[model samples]
Target: MKVLLVTQYFSPENFKSNDIAFELAKRGYDIDVLTGIPNYPEGKYYKGFGLFRKRVEKINGVRVYRSFQFSRGQNKQWRLALNYLSFAFFASIWALFLSLFKHYDCVIVHAPSPIIQALPGILVKKIQRIPLYLWVLDLWPEAMQSGGGIQNKRILTTIENIVKFIYTNSTNILISSEEFRIPILKKGNYNEKIEYFPNWSEDLLFMRQDFDIPALPKGFIIMLAGNLGKSQDLDAVLKAAMEMKNSNNIKWVLIGDGSKKSWIDDAIVKKDLQDNVFTLGRFPFEYMPTFFKSADALLITLSGEYPDLKLVVPARLQSYMAAGRPVLAMIDGAGADLIHKANCGYSVKSGDYISLARIIRDKVFSDLETFEKLGLNGRKYFEKHFQKNKCINHLCKIIDSK
Candidate 1:
């Protein structure tokens, strides 16, 4: 079967769609990815990739068709919107012609930011007369209002309409969490075909490694990695850091780059937390497991403003669990529910730093045996639920059953 996977952001950019498409390719499906140049989160064009209407490359046996569009970082809201719209505009024209000439059996779209790529995706679906599957990582408008730092209600309403249109038109909807399915059902008349297929991290590299890195203080390290954008309340973690600053053993490391990096840097200096808090900017994805396994606890935070956000789990959550690390979450809704059910981690009040600090202190310092058990439990949970082949198999089943 030939599957055309569409996403605005893709691999070499660290988006989940890249991993999904690669897995499908491994299953003997002919995979073609329609994506823009590798620019995301930071929005700068990647090295060696020129600004052009189209480019092509083969990475890990998957044929990737890279189109060109204006790129801008997420720090500027208007430019970010333009970047998404520009890609949608140019990529749609590119795909309409591409699909007219080529035959594809299925069209799978990774809906991380829906408004950005929905036009091209839906247009291709209609033009090709193929089964369209919207694999949503984040809900639109709600995610924008909550995460994208968007406040314009009229624009939000428009995006919601587009979301409804896509949901109603698609043959199937694949959501990463069960919490995500409810909203789609509420918005459209397609509950029967809405399927929850959680994302799986590439466990081969993320799984605990035997490498012996130098140990830190006697207590455990509570680490948070990835983009610290508006949706994530990293200030809560910094607050937790301030409270635990005096502890010699408990160290807090915040890694990755985002608009909030400068804010976090300023806050660290203001709090006089230079010793207890460390911010490592943007390490390569390959090195993630080194830090994941080295830490005693992995930290996740979700801002409390968007109640609808409960429908999704951040993809990084899987990586930490895959590395056999215990998780500590300052999150609510779906992620919190998963942690509770798996019994792999403790959850503090969403955006509550005081409670998070106390929990970290207790978990990282109090009981070594329990900490080890929690870490193992997380690995077991990954093995049972989120292994990569399992997700790929489920996706194939959905396509075949349809």
Candidate 2:
């Protein structure tokens, strides 16, 4: 089968979509990826790439096509919007032409806002007419509104219209959580085309691993990995760290970078938490497993408490479980439910730092053996539910059924 994966970001760029595309290629499927320059949370172009030169390269048996697009940065709202828009515009134009000549069975589009990159899939479905499966990592305008990132009423309305248009026209929609299904059904009068496709943990990264937890330090290590952006209410974690400062050995490490790093740094200095807090910014994607193995527990946090926001399923949760480490989630909605179901970690009030700190103190200090058990249970749950083969096979079923 020939598949075209549409995303604004791709390989040599740190993103889950890149790994998924490459894995598909390795499984004997012909895969082509369309993406922009490798500038992510930082917004600046990568070290080696020139501004105007777009390259076509084959990496690990997958064909990747790059094009001109604005990089995201710590800039004004319009600039960020323009960056996404430019990629959407250029990628759609490039994809439309590519589809004219190449024979493709299906086009799977990873999440793209304003329903922009999906335009090419729509074009191909209308022209050569093939199945266009949308892998919705997030529900559009709703995610924007929940994050407090989209305020312009006119623009929000426009985005809402686009969401409805794409969902209505799509052959099938793949969503991560059941919560996502509800909002789309309520807002757009969906035709029951949504399928709940859970995210998977990398087989190589997450699983039962025999690693020495005692070798690292005397204190219990809790980590928060992945992007630290506005949508991540990591401040609560800091507050938890503050509350537990004088207690038993507890250390908090934040891995990855985003718009909120400087703010977190400022908070760390203000709180005088030099001893307990650590930040390892933007490590390579391949190295994530080591950190997961090293930590005694993993932390996941979401910024807001909007009703719509509760439905999000963070990709890092799977990574944490794969490492067989207990997870501490300061998240609401469906994600919290997952933790509760696995009995792998504690799920506290969404943004309540005091309760979070208390939970950590209670879990780690009061009963050390129970803490270890939770971590072991988490790893077991990943083995039962989130293996990579299960993920790819589920996706194949979705494609075949469509």
Candidate 3:
């Protein structure tokens, strides 16, 4: 089968679509990707990638077509808007051209955010009458509102209308979390179409060999990987570290980068947490498994209270589980529920620094046997649910379904 994968972010930008496209191609599917210039967490084009750089390239035998889109600079809302809309516009034009010449059986839209990413898939579906599957990784207006991105009611309503249109048009809507179903249903008539298709850990994480990296710091490392943004509520982690400064030999290692890195750096300096807190910035996606293996526990944090993070499941959780490490979740809703259900870690209420500190000091630091057991449980849970082959097979079934 020939599949067209549409997304704003792709490989070299640390997105799951990179693995998805490669895996689909490996499974004997002709995969073509439609994406923008590789610029993501850094908010600028990657080296050798710019507005006029190579628009077409091949990676691992899969054909990739790039489009022109504005870069999302640091906290620039206008540029961010252009980054989203411009990709949608150019991607749609590219998809329309592809549909006219390329014979594709299906089009899969990877909607990580800015639901506008699905615009190209919708256009291709309209022109070729092929199946269009939308894999929603994040909810739109709610994520924007929660992250303090879009505040104007009028603009929010307009985005909601666009979301409704895209959801209504797609042949299948694959939600990363079960909780996402109701909100999407409220937006469009997709009751029969909506399927629970959660994200999976990359195959490399499972296959990676343990290697000793000298740069790894000593102490009981409690690592947090991925975007250190405001939505992650990492300030709570810093506060917990402050409280547990002299309690144990635990070290708080933060990996990845985002808009909040500057704030975190300033906080570490002001609070004199140089010894307890360590920032590694962003590392290559391939290095993630090694980092997880070197850590004692993996930390996952989300902002807000119990119901605040109900509809989404952070992709990092799956990666942590695949690495066979105990998870420490300072979150609630679906994320906490997953950890609890897997029996793979402990959870404290969001923003509860005292509880977070206590857990790190008492449960995590003191109990090695229990932590190992939790890590085992997490790996088992990952194999049963978030394994890449299983998820991809399920996706294939959905694509081939009539």
Among these predictions, the greatest lDDT belongs to: 3
lDDT of 2 by residue, 31-110 (tens): 98887888776788887764555468788898888867887667467777788788878887878788787888888888
Candidate topping TM-score:
3
The per-prediction tally of clashing pairs is 0, 4, 0
Question: Against the true structure, what is every candidate's RMSD?
Answer: 2.2, 2.7, 1.7
- Write candidate 1's Cα lDDT for 69-89 as tens digits: 778775887888788888888
lDDT of all the models against the reference? 0.80, 0.78, 0.86
Global Cα lDDT for candidate 2:
0.78
Q: Encode model 3's per-residue lDDT on 1-402: one tens digit a residue.
A: 999999999987777798789988999999999999988988888999887777899999999999888888787778888899999998889988998999889999999878899998899988988899999988887877877556799998998888889888888889899989888877766899888999898654556656544486778899999998888998898999988898768889999898799999999999999999999888777788888878889999998742436667899999888888889988878888899999999998788889988877788768788887898898889989999899988988898785
How much is 106 displaced in model 3, in angstroms?
Answer: 1.2
Task: Tell me which of candidates 1 and 2 scores higher on lDDT.
Answer: 1
* Winner on TM-score (1 vs 2): 1
Residue pairs clashing in model 2 are: 43-72, 206-322, 207-322, 233-303
The TM-score of predicted model 1 comes to 0.94
